[model samples]
Target: MREFVFALEYEPGCNRVADALADHPDARIRSLSLHATDDRLWRVDHATGTSAALEDIEGAFLNGDYYADCLATDDCGATQTTRVLDRTDDTLVLYSTWERTPTCASVPHIARDHLGDGVLFETRHEGRHYTWRIVHSGVGDPAAFFDALEAAVGDCARMEMLRAATTEADAPTGDGTGGASGLAPEQEAALRAAVEHGYYESPREVDVGDLADHLDVPRSTLTYRLRRAEERLAKGYVADERFADAPSTPL
Candidate 1:
């Protein structure tokens, strides 16, 4: 297996969404970062670090978190969110959510889908939404990976609205959405900025170019790095689960 990472940036006034995300299923509170905004939510994931045997992949789709939060303002303010899952060694679904709408005109290569061993991430802040997905399959052919990731992000971003992929019958609440340990300074900096900038509003306007500029890297590069941060979060959850099952230390 190879390694890949994905990350996302939210707008200024969409803090509420983040609050809801903290409680999302498939979220793995042990694997996410929580921003202090009522309207925003941010996340990162490393999509390539898993060692699943290629033969283990089955033709199936899994649902992650399902979250909802009230929008004080806006006509279609009320919303629920979730993520999609696939375990194909040939392909992986990095990120999926109903947090908020995307703002980019054209999806960046990093956010596409169908690439092998890639990562995907999404975030909402200040009403502006951001998504990133990457692929680093051992095949070393990121062209198709990039194209697919970009298309996925683009398709997801342009969505008029996002719906929860699950129903209460399946999940009463949902997955946990928290922070992972290995978040880079840059990724954390972006999260901090989203908080400091007041970009966590539901309908807040955000500039992807501006955020890229702030991080001092191309949007694609930043997206990859952010995904790495998310991997750490996801790994943290796995570690915690294992630790939970392990024998406890003597008092």
Candidate 2:
């Protein structure tokens, strides 16, 4: 089994859902579902944010145009439909299905085309970056996949390869020195930047945007690193059994 992970960094306002995240900067999106297909890309997003922000996200999601960025052409005449479920004050659930087009497009369709069928997709969207972690059952050529992905991304967004196969640095433990456990150097740097920049202070010494500026990286890049770091640290505080039966859903 191989996990070919990659991320897409879109220009602000280039992606509708990403643009929506920009409007509600505090909202975070996570997907966990296996539901997808060649003609349809299914998404089940669990959104956390202020109620107003969730509402806005819901509206933006229901707007079919929110999916234009994923299609081969804005006028490809593809169709997208969404449904809202499990509404809450701080969290909202959204499900969407995007039908495919003849033109090679979308991470899901393109991945299936090159990587073979049954390639699972998972995504996290916030701000300009839409991160995808694809789970493929068989060994595949990541370079070939990325080349196809890069062409599909084209001028609309910048693409970066984050992590694919596990590496020594990705080990659950670090060198037997005073170094903290697990965190990749980049992840650690992101957390350090955030803390030093007062990102954790009340009212925040600076929001993500300003902190990102201080670090001289795009906001999407900073957020991706920070979020990955936090997830690892947070898991350290919980019991392994707590997630023994957790669902692994794909976006």
Candidate 3:
């Protein structure tokens, strides 16, 4: 199967649920179960935040014309039926089945429209950014899907295509034979956090100290993990045939 990964940045005012979440930067929603058909979208989400955030989120889900992952909605649009599976002061579990309307456009619908069936979706909603990991049996052109999604989203949201690749379904995820990023789990975690937080960006969005605090790890530990991860990546890169074929000279 192939995987098409992308992200959407929901600027406030474009989406009610995302707007309600704008104030709670630390709040996050994780997908538990999700499926979509031509007529309905069913989802179960795990949300964590303060009471205020949860309350606003709940209202947005069941009240006025709110729908997650939808770019637009209009009057007389079909509303969603939502239930609170569980709620706590800082966490909420929600189950919703939404009726699809022609006035609205969502990621899953667009994907099905373009990419066809036999696709699975996983999502992560953090702050203003939502990342979607879609797996399909190579149904449609990922490039076309990206363009369609961007055009459909228009000015309501920003789209970034992270990955568009085809992989064997039975391929080993990682053989642990020290090939292609054979990092220890801790090292990989630290490196991923660093990259996600822009540690490697030019002019550096974050330093090791800042990233350590972000991950709740000690400064020294983070530094070591990053250093080791970088070493492995650099060595692997230089060892590849493409690099070996390039002209190089010792300084």
Candidate 4:
């Protein structure tokens, strides 16, 4: 079967939470997941440097016409009776039930309808754009899915294909040696976090110190881990000619 990964970008003005996050420089929704019960429910996980902004989010939910109820903060975040919300200090997790299904124009909703069974791996808000990682099995024609997605999002959004590969359904999944790099889970997480946080950016949005703080590790420890992880990834790239055409950047 064929599996495709796509990164979809959405406009901030079109989404309420996205707009609120855009207003807060240090606040962002790190991940989001939606499930359809009797009522459609969304689980939103976010991070913000400022606590006041989080309170503002809570207020937005309570006062807004969209949500039905609001609850107090727990160890995780906060929960509304109609939904679930939690915040641990700077990190926020929200579970909200929607009164109605998402419109057909929604990109994710379109993908869901077309793919039949697709996976939303991750979702994050950065600046004016919200990026989503969606993976799906190819139906009769994968191009058809893209066409539908483009039509749903219109000319305002951008969609990039990150990876497309075919694998047997019963393929072995032991140590992941058959995969790209055999780096340990911790190493993989460190490398992904580094890239996502813009550690490799020319201007460098975050430094090792900042990454260490985010990971709750000592600066020296983070340095050692990153160095080792980079080395492993580099060696993996060099050993595999399949990635020879890929970008030279470590990420």
84-152 per-residue lDDT for model 3 (tens digits): 999999999999988877777788888888888978999877655676889888767767777878887
Instruction: Put down candidate 1 lDDT per residue, 1-251, tens digits, no spaces.
Output: 33333333322233333322322312211223222122234332222212331111111112212222222223233233434343443433323233343321122222222332233333322122333222233444555654544444332232211111122344334321122334545666665665455445566455546666876756644444444446656787998899999998899
Separately for all candidates shown, the number of backbone clashes (residues 3 or more apart, or on different chains) is 62, 4, 0, 8
lDDT of 4 by residue, 1-251 (tens): 45554444435444445456556756766666654333234555555646876766655555454442211111212223323366766866765554333231344445555666544446665433454545456565567767977765565455654445554463355333333555545556778889999999999999999999999865644654576578767886776766777688876
Flag the better candidate by lDDT, 1 or 2. Answer: 2
Query: Which 10-residue span in candidate 1 carries the lowest summed lDDT?
Result: 53-62
Query: Which 10 successive residues of model 3 have the least lDDT summed?
Result: 170-179
By TM-score, the candidates rank as 2, 3, 4, 1
Residue ranges of candidate 3 with Cα displaced over 4 Å? 73-76, 168-251
Residue-wise C-alpha lDDT for candidate 2, range 137-193, written one tens digit per residue: 655666777888888777878886655553234435443223364565666888988
Q: What is the RMSD, in Å, between candidate 2 and the native fold over all Cα? A: 6.9
The numbered model that scores best in TM-score is 2
RMSD of each: 18.3, 6.9, 11.1, 12.6
lDDT of 4: 0.55
lDDT of 1 at 212: 69
